[model samples]
Target: MAEALREQQLCLSRFIRDPHSNPAPPGIEARRLAVYRQLFLGNMQSLLAGSFPVLSATLAQTQWQSLTTEFYACHRCKTPLFTEVAGEWVSYLETRSDLPGWVAELAHYEWIETVLLLSDNADPAHDPEGDLLDGVPLLSSLAMPLAYAWPVSHIGPDQLPLEAPVEPTLLLARRGADQKIHFARLAPLAHALLVSLQQQLLTGREHLDALAQRAGVERGALERQGIALLHGLKAQGVVLGTVRG
Candidate 1:
């Protein structure tokens, strides 16, 4: 009896997800089944549209509907929460080769703001006035360094690019103290530094010295410019001063 009930539930769910492919559950009214199918797919589309407005806007209405419908029918979402539905869609897009290659990257770029905003991680204890060079520079928990092949930050309804640029797009996505999410372009050096900071808990000067070595530049020259960059990051709240000793 339990197995039969489970099978019925699966049939109903599958049909609701893709009525065109999956047969309607036995003994259910066609009218009611259509309503259920519409409700489920419509809700998923609406939720994804909110999360990835840029992607939704860039695609034609039919394209967007078809994309969402395919995701609804084919993707297996691990989470039941509406907030996570966008992430699932992004993941699903990554696996799809039929779609444009830049589509997944664009979706990820737009979805980043949602990820940072929903994160419950509190800021780590740090000094707001400590020296960045002398002490360890602490990046805010909300700040994320992202590198993408597609120029996702620039892609929109009217500004889609046919091919990726020679240089990869590097971005810093951070949630500020005021609870606002912001994105900024990062230079190659800055991107590498932030990525290194994540991997190592070294002082700002030490990180710069290592960076200079890697770049085959004079340590003193790089230090001057690197220190200024570090200061600017602190000003933007990306570098939350220094780690509290």
Candidate 2:
């Protein structure tokens, strides 16, 4: 009896996962299987659609449907939570060869906003008014740096690029005190500085010196420019403040 039940479960699982290719278990009504398939796949489609609205908008309806169905059929999601399905979809894209090269990057960019929205990271304790150059700069726990090869930030239904740009896109997504998420395009220098700050090992002055050396500029001039940039980031709530030490 146990072996029979196990076989039945396996057959049902295969049918539900890929109804088009897999036959239903013996004695199961076709209509009943169809209802189950529709319910399960529809829910998955709706969840992914909500999570990746921009990707959905960029693709043709048939393409989107085909992509989602492929994901549903082949991707064994790592998490049972509905909120994480979009993340799973992003991962699934990495294994696919038929889709456009930019699709994965675009889906990941959309997923970052969802991740920031649901992040439980709290504001770090720091002096908001502290000097940015003199002390170590502390990046907000809610902000993240992202880089993409295909200008994922600019891609949409009307703005899809057929070829990758020469320069990669760098962006920062930061959640504000009001709980609103904001995205900012960053110059390569600004993005590198923010990444340095995130490491939490370098003081603001050290970062400036390192950046100056990389750019082969005078440290004093870079320090002046770096301070201005840090101040602007502080105003935008991306850099929380300087550490006491």
Candidate 3:
């Protein structure tokens, strides 16, 4: 009985994993299978494309179909649910050998925005400590900040960037206190500073000091910038506590 159940699960997974190829049970003819195959493929493709419109627009139709085909083959999402499929699809693309480095980076650039928008985690709406300038942990509300070595911030329908940007592009993604998603380009030092602070590699002061060194700013200027950043964080509703914690 258990073996039969497992086989059933595998059969359904195969249909979902690559609907264009496999369809229903033994009694179902290839023609009948094609009907289901079309629906399955179209549904999944539209859902992903909706979330990644820029990415979809950039690719040729043939390439888009091929890309989705590859995704159907490579990704084995542990959950049976479809809502989380986008996460697995994005994760799959990051390591896919057949895809070019630039395309992988571009997909990730768009994927993160979706991830932030759907994140289930929620930090408090307000910080009671209220010491915005203290040297405590500096974190994005979700603390899953990411950036890329390419300029994917301006990804649009007009065209894909022909060359990678010499400078790194920072991505600040978080659900704001207003319950809306915000994604913005960040300076390299700012990205490094936030990442360092989140990893506890440095305190807030230490991060600002590093940024100051990199940007060739004076200590006083750095302190002022750090204070400003804290106020920004407070406004975003991610301040957890003071350094005394």
Candidate 4:
């Protein structure tokens, strides 16, 4: 009896997930199945649209519907939470070949805002008044440095590029004290600097010294400019502050 009930449930789920290909379970009315399919698909679309507003707006009406429908029918979402549906869709898009190559990157770019806003990571113990150059600076747990092949920030209905730029688009996404997510483009050097800071527990001067060696510039020259840049990032809440120790 349990096996039969489980099979029935699977059949119903398959039909709801892909009604076009999977027939309804035996004895279920077509009207009732239609309602179930509509409700499930509608909720999925709404959640995706809310999370990836730019991606939805970039695709045409039929294109958007087809994209959402295919994702709904084919992708087996690993997460049970509705909030994570966008991330699952982004992962799904990465595997798809029919869509534009940039689609996944753009979806990820859009979805990052949702990730930052919903992040539960708390600020680490640090001194907001500590010296940035002398003390090891701490990057906010919520700050992320993203690099993509396509210029995701510029892709929209009116500005889709057929070819990727020679240089990758580098972006820093961070949540401010006001609990709002902010995004900014980063120069290659700046991007490298932020990534180094995030990955290592190093003092600001040490980070800049390494950057200078790699960049083949005089340590004094880079240190002067890098110190100011770090301070600016601190003002923006990207640099949480120096470590307490």
Which sequence of candidate numbers ranks them by lDDT, best first?
4, 1, 2, 3
lDDT (10s digit) by residue, model 3, range 24-117: 5565577766776677777888988987787788778899888887776666678777767877777878877876566777777777777777
Which stretches of candidate 4 lie above 4 Å from their native place? Answer: none
Model 3 regions lying over 4 Å from their true place: 1-25, 124-134, 201-203, 210-221, 236-244
Q: What digit string (tens of lDDT, one per residue) describes model 1 on residues 1-245?
A: 99999999999998998888988898989999888888888888898998889999999999999999999888888998888888898899999899887899999998989999999988788999999999999988899999999899888999989988999999999998798999989999999889988788999999999999999999999899989999999888788898898
| Alpha carbon lDDT of each predicted model | 0.91, 0.88, 0.69, 0.92
Which residue pairs in candidate 1 have backbone atoms (N, alpha carbon, C) closer than 3 angstroms, thus clashing?
A: none
149: Cα error in model 1, Å: 1.8
30, model 2: CA deviation in Å? 0.9
Better of 1 and 4 by lDDT: 4
Residue pairs that clash (backbone atoms under 3 angstroms), model 3:
none
Q: Rank the candidates by TM-score, best first.
A: 1, 4, 2, 3
Q: In model 4, how large is the Cα lDDT of residue 88?
A: 96
Give the TM-score of each candidate: 0.92, 0.91, 0.79, 0.92
Candidate that beats the other on lDDT, 2 or 3, i.e. the better one: 2
lDDT of 2 by residue, 162-188 (tens): 999899999999887788888889998
Model 3 earns a TM-score of 0.79
Indicate the TM-score of model 1. Answer: 0.92
For lDDT, candidate 3 versus 4, the one ahead is 4
